[model samples]
Target: MLNRVKRFADKTPFSLTTPNPQEYTLFNQAILYGVLIEPYFTKIHIKHLHAIIIDGYKLFLSLLVGIVNELYGKLVNSGKEQLIWVTKEMIDVSATRIDSLLVCLMRQIVGGDFSNGNLWLCFELVSLCLSKWDCLLQEKPVVLTSALYTFLRLLADHCRVSNNLKPMMLRQMEIEFFVKMLRDQFQLCLKIGRDLFHVPF
Candidate 1:
């Protein structure tokens, strides 16, 4: 079935199905989270929440990988390749957004935002940071800086929620040991002269 669909799409000219890229991306992301991820986001189970966070972080990292591919100029150029790239990118971002949506879900489940829920908050924070992976890769200082600011606030909120969350999360958050990763991105922004304000990408 997938092969049949791919073959049909392959035969159609890009012009026939073309849409505004940004709008396409937005719609795709929304559908992924709203339809697919929402099913597994039940907060009654911390395991589900944990899974959401892990999936979100993975999605964010996927963006970083995509940016890397884009940087190396590996952007898909046609048919099957382009279709694969688009699908992968949308899935990555959708996974991340669903992770973020869980934030509001957690709030609903917990009866309020738990400031000390560092694990959830920080996971979201890192997602935001990596969300700017394009800006970072394209050397867009201003956008990266803005991402950093948002990341800081998310981290701070997590800190306010619960101390135990961090400690418990820490043992598992080993991959995120570089807690201040955003600071590195910030320095890069300053070094580049934050002059344009517009993301270069």
Candidate 2:
């Protein structure tokens, strides 16, 4: 099935399906299920996929994020962790491919009705990101930064509820560790730049 889908994607002429109203839905579902079944996202560039969509990047991103949230919900809600461990692994791999998924989602989800829609998705992603911070920082530093920045930006924008949520979020993020990490990286960058431009003393 996977091979067939790939072949179809690769061989089909874009013009033929260009006008189909359901094309984006079909593509989104196929990609979502493919990722769930075999974890095939690690090698693909999300931007490339975004370019192939008929409906525009916003709709594509919305569908992608919706599936991602669905995936997270299923993984967390499933009773047997041992059996569902592979599902978690798949989710992690997909994250590596599109490191900015959650960050990008912030733009897609901001607004008046965000509580159940965008806010909920952002909360789920922030929780997952905090839980996996150490590993994500080591393997995908950009993703970690993007996720943290997005969460912080949201807090700044929504002062009322964010004030109550700030302490919990900071605790989960291990504020001290993150601050130290940022300082260390900043110092390293400065040292590198200074050494590069240094003159004989």
- Assess the local accuracy of residue 54 in candidate 2 as a C-alpha lDDT between 0 and 100: 54
Q: Where in model 1 is the C-alpha error above 4 Å?
A: 1-112, 115-122, 128-135, 139-141, 160-162, 166-183, 186-201
For 42-89, candidate 1 gives per-residue lDDT tens digits of 122223222234234344334434433343233222322222233334
Clashes of each: 7, 0
- Which candidate wins on lDDT? 2
State the lDDT of candidate 2 residue by residue for 42-75, as single tens digits: 2242323444565434454454555545554454
- The lDDT for every candidate, in the order shown, is 0.36, 0.45
